[model samples]
Target chain A: MLAKPGLLVLGLALGLSTLLPSEAEAHRRWLLPSSTVLAGESDLVTVDAAASNGLFLFDHRPMALDSLVITGPDGAPVDPTILGAGAYRSMFDVPLRAQGTYRIALVSDGVMGSYELNGERHRFRGSGDALPAGATNISSSRSNSRTETFVTLGAPTDTALQPTGSGLEMIPVTHPNDIVAGEPAVMCFLLDGQPAADLEVEFVAGGTRYRDEPGIVMLRTDAEGRVTLQPSEAGMYYLEVSSSQDAANGQPGRRASYTAVLEFLPL
Target chain B: MRVSIAFAFAATGLAAAPSAAQEMAISVEIPRLKVAEYHRPYVAVWIEDAAGKSVRTLDVWYDVDLKPEDGAKWLPDMRTWWRRAGRSMTMPANGVTAPTKAPGTHSRTYRQGSRPLANLPAGSYNLQVEAAREVGGRELVTVPFQWPPKALTSASARGKSELGAVRLTTKR
Candidate 1:
């Protein structure tokens, strides 16, 4: 009977962590960094100042790229070429050195920001395309030198299944954590209601800039599409989910979209 | 029918929740509900719980047929409401199936018993509303609300210009 009690305690512990997953993640925010894109090794990437301001979607209002900086992998400054009226672009040729992961951080000294990228270091989904539920932007005070951005890449979330198969799934949603400290909470995205594997996803946070660098967090989803993190702090958190891998290509954009649910608890 | 049914979605951060709590209840209404945006104002209301943190978009009254696909877009605003109720249910039968609300009094009730409030046992919560108009601005008002079946039976807050007075009452 005593052994059973201990077993019960062990079972309770297991249920708590798995059921709640990670206690509410603190709010995460980052400023969009101006990183230079390399040509060749054509894997598309999308950059945004923040995910929450909704300006990243351009539905709120078009962001002025002129108010931003640009960089390239060759460690040189790059110019913003007018793609459409307000849209701008610079091609990336230098590939991420190896299969190893790197991150593209967005940096801006002013205002809060949120952003995300998918790769091995922070893979949150199951395929090359990720339906990221949320992202985080970090604040930074860097140089104003106009040049090509030098960014390390995070492990991108890879989309493994064709939505045409068992079909695209719905992302999870939760409440808003009004009290926590972070602005952009990394909302977790799970396919089939669990952490998935090997998918490309993106993250967007408050309008703060990461200066084209990935911050301290590098979370990866398990086979169930879940990203559980043990935070060093406690606060409000939100995640935005997007499945559109081609968002970097400016195509239909990321698919399987869901807003991150708010999580508030102690670290 | 390609008419535009304009609406708004917004949130309010009412209060902070305690560390170990369980569940939240949401009730919503609008004294300004009506048919047209310029007229009185059709309103949408809902509950957003923990399991489904997105607005459990409980109720909405606007011209669903205004456009073939108008009502679908506004679903994202009630972040908490959408996840619990809106995301899973079909639009026609969900809380927001109605076409518009009258201008008198309207109210709805919800509970977060048994289930984790969006996976959290208990904590603080906020009530948010977005009031949008055709030629007017959309206003989102939030008031803080707490949890754990407290001694407080009723709470109230004033809505933005688009809405009249707002009040909440709990029952046994």
Candidate 2:
């Protein structure tokens, strides 16, 4: 759940960080896979990473791939091939050498705050150690975010879907690759390995540029931190959640955000 | 007297198989569509109870001869059947899985005491046939009927796109 008071403080702190432009909040980030499920002795799937105002259009700047992580079914990191970043999107190809699921994610963590140096206020966005020396009145908050998507080679497996217990994450109750339109899919949110209750989630289907309405669905997680999504149509959809936690016991305020790109097949 | 009659019948070596008492026949029609690329559609035929739970999967027509046996990859294209029963069972199931059929009407029959219908309880059930084609659309047709038929019964349904006329008949 989002702490209201913490959000106000975090909002002010975020405003002080000139490094994070307003476009960062308006733009949506996603990872789109060429295919979620595959079969054969060996199959390859291409992926696109981008951030855009129009859902999945890739009209805005390319999402950074510096923190990209690809975990194979065997719980080992797999290197992606044909990795390249263009003006609008970053691209990569992953070979499904083993049969099971693969998780592709981009994880980033940083701090945003302001400090006073010789009576002048300065803003920064990076690790706390990166702050200037002899700084005073340091007000900072930690931010962690993850963007992810899943692909399966043969049979869908759950090993790759396990949460790392580091930041905000989603564990799919319904196999991500098996989602179908008109059927309900359950997903549970966890914050640092615990259920994140009462958090608001935004669900938006792709093809926003053509539709008359954006068709955004607002959902809230239950006490158990689960949300059941029933998409009426088949297409690529994006889910996003962001929340702020108040500072407690001398700890700095914290913000966590999660985003995922999911594809729903027609029934 | 009844014992004597039974003895006489046994002496004559006259006996009927239990399965001969009841039978079910189904006909599925895959329509020919004029399109740029045409491939035989993967089809699934099964029975479901009133609660929509699958009772039996009678037939599954897919590409069983693909190299490396990767043909099952597209099984999910038949989304309805895949979700209901296909995913639960292994592919190439004996007597149930078959090669995809070309555009035409195909028929099959199942006896009451056979592999699939042997233990089906007497109740209201639906005969569902679904077809999904690559680079094409999908269609499903259903026919409702009762098991352990009171008398000769027949029903048929038509599909608009991928499938044509589907008929089901039962006898007891």
DockQ, candidate 2, comes to: 0.27
Candidate 2: tens digits of C-alpha lDDT, residues A213-246: 9889999999989999999999999999877876
Writing each residue's lDDT as its tens digit, candidate 1 over A1-267 gives 122354345436544321110111212222233322121122233443322233123222222244333333333334443333233222223234321112222221211112354522231212223335544332211111111112323212112111112112323221122212323333334443444464443332322242354323445444556443333344322343333232333232223333322223331
lDDT string, candidate 1, B33-147, tens digits: 4445454344555433443254335455555665543554444233333323444555555434676665555665453331122223344555555554555545555555555
For all predictions in the order shown, the interface RMSD in Å is 14.8, 3.1
| Model 2 stretches astray by more than 4 angstroms | A1-25, A37-42, A72-79, A97-101, A112-114, A120-133, A152-157, A246-249, B1-21, B116-118
Q: Across residues B1-172, which tens digit of lDDT does each residue of candidate 2 receive? A: 5346435445654323333347788999998889999999999999999899988999999998887647887886777787677766777789999999999989998876555665568899999999989999888899999877988899999999999999998977
Fnat, 2 decimals, each candidate: 0.00, 0.35
- Where does the lowest 10-residue lDDT sum fall in candidate 2 chain A? A16-25
Candidate 1 segments whose C-alpha is farther than 4 A from its true place:
A1-182, A185-267, B1-42, B48-56, B77-89, B94-96, B109-128, B141-152
Model 2 error, position B82 (Å): 1.6
Whole-structure CA lDDT of model 2: 0.83
